[model samples]
Target: MQLSVLDQSVAVTGRTEDASIRETLTLARHCEALGYRRFWVSEHHSHPTIVGSAPEVLMAAIAATTSRIRVGSAGVMLPHYAALKVAEQFRVLEAIAPGRIDLGVGRAPGSDMRTARLLSSDPRQSADNFPIQVRELQAWLAGVDLPEGHPGRGVTANPMGPSAPEMWMLGSSDYGAQLAAHYGLPYAFAYFITDGQGAGQALDLYRANYRPSPRHPAPQAVLCVWALAADTEAEAWHHFSGRERWKIDRNRGALAALPSPEEVALRPYTPAEQMEADKLRANAFVGSGPQVAAKLRALANTLEVEELVVITWAHDPAARRRSYELLAREFF
Candidate 1:
């Protein structure tokens, strides 16, 4: 099995953005030493808790910091930028680190509508043209000519290299899965966000409708999930509590920085909030080292996926790093 990481550079309640980003670099090195295959950063906009608004820039930093781990985006939101620009940016990355970059693209805005407008001139129009944009991006990356009379037929993304970055389509729903299958691209399902529901159906649909292309001759799938591990089950839950509260805040449209475990423990929760938290907890794999390994194995078996991209959310950097350390020791 191949294990990878998806880091959002989440801000701790009392830490600076710089501290969060520094920890990201440190975690990249840590995961690389632990034998992780890939290190992917996420893209978010106007989110107080998330500092990873520009995944390509952060990916470059991670690539510069670590030598072995493949660095890429969990996804760059395709609706916010020109397809040629996206291809050019990733081409430059591939030039710097050949055969070690992945370009994961998504159709969603990655933010609220207001922020989407800030990032894109015509947010709705851009989203409506997602499929067309994806085709153009593929053409640019492959250095092939678009169809006759296409807008980008003659234009080329300069500095096209010998190889293009491996491309993957990221999605939380079956729409994305079908689209990815149509393009013959690898698909990554956001099991963490969907709480593991409907994943089987989506993956099944992807495989059933997949068509072979030069970029991906066979169907490939990856499950991106939330996970945490520690020496004891109690310690693991202690770290997970903060993330639970953060999820509740997100549900309530309150995007606060991640609270400390100690802070979460002292708060009084109503029955409704507690119920919501319980539901949110279902999405995470949190336990002692052995228990987490067993659960992950079971999930992989059930989903029929060989690759896992783990996202660990914790208030303290040490706890987050420890979680990965324990999991790596258990799994690798």
Candidate 2:
């Protein structure tokens, strides 16, 4: 199975955004050397823990820093910007690294409603126009004309060449699966965020209804999940404690930098919080290299996906890197 990474450039309790970005670049290079297929960064706006607000800029930086690994967004929230602009930005990236660039688009806001309004021209629109946006983006990227009488019919996203960046639709629901199937694009399921709920159904729907397009002739699906590995099961649990605490805090509407294991150990938690954490933990894979490897392989086999994109968070940058290193050694 192929393995990839989806890094949020998470800011730890004691680290600055600059430090977080540096760690992202370092991790990209490390994963590339370790033979990862792709290294994708996330986009979040006004989030205390996440530092990746602009995936296009970060993708360019990662592409310049790494030689072999494909770099892209995990993805860019499409509703926030014009499709033509998004296409242009990624086209420039394609020029920078050609086939190494990917344009993963999603419909979510990637932030709270308040921040969403700030980014979007009309935040109150109840009906989602993401299907229309995707069509425009695809047209611009392919340098093809939109349907006659369309507002974007005459517009062209410049820098178009013989090849465009690969596009993948990212979603956690059946709606996204159906949309991707209709468009004949590759689909990536956010299993970590959805806690593995409805994933089987979503993938099944995508495969059953998928139409062949020039970009993706066959159904290609990727599963993204939270994972961590350590030398021992106990140490891996220690790394996961912070993630558990972070999830609890996030559910309570309290966002903060990723706490350290020591900090998590010292915090007092209610029974409900503990239950929530346990539930989240059940969806995550944390153990020794072989243990995590076995679980990941089983999951991939069950999902029938050839690629797995892992998202790991820890207070220590070294620990995060080590986790990927161990997993790569075990699987790759």
Candidate 3:
């Protein structure tokens, strides 16, 4: 299986948000050295926990700092901006790192409804236009003429070159699967977002309905999963306490920075909260390097996906880096 990374630039308690962004850059270079296939960043607008709001901007920084690793957005929220604008930005990124950019796009707001409205140029813009936007973006990125009668038929994305970003459809639902299959583009299921719910159904739908396109003659699917690995199984669970507590609190509408394991240990969990935490831990991939690798292999086999995009969150940035490092050693 091909291993990749999807970093959310997670904010941690007692650290400035800027530090989180810098850590993502550092992690990208680190992952490259570890022989990972790709390093993708995420987009989340005005989010307290996930601070990676501008994936295009972050992609540029990562491209400049890393040589071999493929850099791209886990996605740019398609509904939030103009298709041509996104295409142009990615085209420029391709110019910087030809044949190494992957343009993953999605329809989700990536923020609260109100914040989404602020990001949209047209206040009345509907996500229903996402398919149309993706079609236009695909044409622009490929330097092909838009179909007749289209409003952006004549306009072009600037800095057109021999290479273009590889476009991938990203989502946590069936709608994205159907759309991706229709376009014959690569699809990445957000297994982390829904905690594996609906993943099998979505991937099944994608491959079944996939149409052949020039760039991708066959269906290409990726699973983005949340996992953590440590030197030992017990140590791994100890660090997992922070993420477990955060998940429980997040379900109750709390969007705080990731707390340290020490902080989480100091506070006692209610029985109800403990139950929720246990559920999360049970479903999570947390253990020593070999153990996590075994679980990852089993998941890939069950899902029939060749590529696994791992995303890890920890209070200490070093731990996050170590998680990826250990996984890379096990796989690569």
> Best by lDDT, which number?
3
Query: What does the lDDT come to for candidate 3?
Result: 0.94
| Clash totals for all candidate models | 0, 0, 0
Query: What's the TM for model 3?
Result: 0.99
RMSD of each: 1.3, 1.4, 0.7
Model 3, span 129-210: residue lDDT tens: 9999999999999999998998888999999999999999999999999999999999999999999999999999999999
Q: 190-282, model 1: which lDDT tens digit per residue?
A: 998888888999999999999999878899999999999988999999889888888887888888889998898789788999899777666
TM-score of each: 0.97, 0.96, 0.99
Clashes of 2: 0
Query: How does each model score on lDDT?
Result: 0.90, 0.91, 0.94
| lDDT by residue (tens digit), candidate 2, 1-332 | 99999999998887677899989999999999999999999999999999799999989999987788999898999988888899999999998888899899998889987888898776554228889899889889988899999998888898977789999999999998999999999999999988899999999999999999987899999999999999999999999999889989888889999999999989888999878877776767999999999999999999999999999999988899999999999877
